[model samples]
Target: MKTQTTVRRSKYAPSVVTKNDLLELLNADFTRECRAIYAHAVYAERTRSRDEGAAARIARYGQETVLSALVLCELIYDYGGTVINNLDELNAVLNADRVADPGWAPETARRLHERAGQLRSAGEPGLAKRIRRIISAKKGAVPLAALVSGQQAVAGR
Candidate 1:
């Protein structure tokens, strides 16, 4: 029997990702989802009076992000891990005390893409495929314009 704890890098991890790499990825993703929900809520609250449409959209997005977090949490548990619950860890940057930094979501997507590539290179193609699905669920990089103008940013919207 083998037991594994969090190990830094893990780039040399086996193709299966049974160690801490995939666990770490899933946890990081959960943290991102938490940040998304927080930012969306803040934006929605601040924009409600001036942009009810955007507020509503933000609320919906927040809900969707919650689902994403739950999914990631489930994965973490199934993979023999605990969901990180550090408040200070779920951090995001906003401008004007209201607007979400335009780069946040796309940066997240970019990191996820990079992680997927790493997983593929490490011989964990199946896990890489899962990450791709999460990226596809975003349609593409979320444009700040969509949040302000109530544009359809999510795919099939």
Candidate 2:
């Protein structure tokens, strides 16, 4: 017997999710969180004296990102997944440009968002939604895509 609820649930199920897929997704998420923590801490250091409130908010988001990463670590382990051991390798694999330019924090967020969209397209909407939350937390002070475009405009000026 078919029910509307069952059909809806079936539509939303992750048809393509696998241990390997989850491992890759979690690794990418882990890298994003690590970089976000660094970026926010650096932002706080760079602008703390000028804008204490903003710096505090950014630092708080960084802490939240740490928590998210911890949750992700648990999820990955539950799925029999392994995390990257070397931070440099993680950064290089995820965002070498971010390492070269810490100011590219917003771009990093955008990149994560895009990656999440890809996950969604690949039938991993749950993971995509989680990644979106991380992106939102990372972009605590400003909308990441808007911030990046604004910076580009200013640079062009």
lDDT of each: 0.65, 0.59
- Give me candidate 1's TM-score against the actual structure: 0.65
Candidate with the greatest TM-score versus the true structure:
1
Record all residue pairs in model 1 with backbone atoms less than 3 Å apart, i.e. clashing. Answer: none
What TM-score fits each model?
A: 0.65, 0.52
Give candidate 2's TM-score.
Answer: 0.52
C-alpha-based local distance difference test score of model 1: 0.65
Task: Give the CA lDDT, 0 to 100, for residue 89 in model 2.
Answer: 44
Tens digit of per-residue lDDT, candidate 2, span 1-157: 8767674534334344555765786687676666656654665564477656655665665577567677666655655678863356444435533532545556666656665665676666776777777677655645322333444454466
- The residue pairs in collision within model 2 are none
Error of 2 at 58 (Å): 1.2
For candidate 1, lDDT tens digit of each residue in 1-157?
Answer: 4457654666544344544776676677777777677777777777787667778877887786777677667656755778885435334534322325556667777777776676677666776777777778776435443574443343226
